[model samples]
Target: MNTFLNPFHLMKRIMLIVTLLLIVSCDGYQSICGLVIDSETKTPIEKAIIKTINPKFKAYSDKNGYFEFHNVTGFIFSDNDLTVVISKVNYINDTLNIKNGDSKLVKLIKTE
Candidate 1:
């Protein structure tokens, strides 16, 4: 039997095409993720506030010092760089110039 004429084969091909389209469309959004750490100790810094300056998206670092902004569309189609600021109570604030779909390791200096 011809593959194109087979009903099951045709259905499978259609499904594959739809799946690929969905995957490609999802690339329009960006995810920003990072780990906040102490500059001197090199340890994870909990309760750190991470935010983007332009689009005003904010997230707090979890106990493991992991923070993420998911499906962020701001600046995704723009040429301007995304600025991220991380700050904690005793740690000095840190800023990073990041792009869409970028992950970074931010180190904050401790305040005396």
Candidate 2:
């Protein structure tokens, strides 16, 4: 009878520990920012598509080629584990891997 009671108590303690971990881990969340520029001219390209493979996240570059990915939460984004595919109407597509929890600068070159 005592052995059976011990398992239930242990399970409850494990669940409580997991719950506390979830709440405290939220403090490590971060956002990302960057700019997209033309590789040749060093000019910024507006409305370029920026995409992440994990979580299937996507954003568009603004007129100044500035992009901000906000509140991107997940465990898969640890330690620079993101891949971005940048594209525009006339430019060639470019793919890059980025570090997590930090800003990045990317340039996409256009080909005639």
Candidate 3:
């Protein structure tokens, strides 16, 4: 007994495989998580507004100055182009790049 495969089916299967590979390998989304701290005192700065400049995402630091971007977390893969802007009253504005899946500590200096 011999088995035969249809050429159209084979082409469709190849196209589907290629599409799936592209979808999985493509960089889709990104996220940022970090701690906002006072540069002088070395203490966590709570309630600071952390906003992404490009994608326009926003979050606020907790009591420990820890903030996590939930939207970014939703994505499984991302590149290295995420910037988070940290700002608070009486403190200097700061910007940080989220990279390497590492948590960053952003220090803000108080203005006189």
Candidate 4:
């Protein structure tokens, strides 16, 4: 009989299949974690609104100007373009490219 069809080969195939299944069953999600800061003063900007489209997701900066959003599907199965909009009261809206699974530094300019 061919060694390829032996029980060892069969067991190996089953293990391979199980491994693939486990990988596919994992959560297909991305995340964006960062801090929002002032363009000039370089200080943290609290209460900033962060929004991303194409499987839309939103988050707000905390008192330390830190923001994070998980389970992001930023243009995953679509176009390569991903946009992130950061805005706050009396501040110039800052538009940035989405960087999945990375920490970013978002700067906003104050409008007067």
Most lDDT-accurate candidate: 1
Error of 4 at 65 (Å): 0.4
In the range 17-103, model 3's lDDT, one tens digit per residue, is 999998787655555588888999999998999998776878999999999875553234545557788999999898887763568
Ranking by lDDT: 1, 4, 3, 2
Q: Write the per-residue lDDT of candidate 1 for residues 2-108, one digit (tens) a residue.
A: 87889999999999999987766653555789999888989998889998886788999998899999766653346556788998998888889887778899889
List clashing residue pairs in candidate 4: none
Q: Could you list the CA RMSD of all candidates, in the order they appear?
A: 7.3, 3.9, 4.2, 4.7
Residue-wise C-alpha lDDT for candidate 2, range 8-112, written one tens digit per residue: 888998899999888767534446778999999999999999887765789999999998776666553246456778888889888877666577878776888
Model 1 misplacement above 4 A: 1-28
All models: lDDT? 0.83, 0.79, 0.79, 0.82
Clashes of each: 0, 2, 0, 0
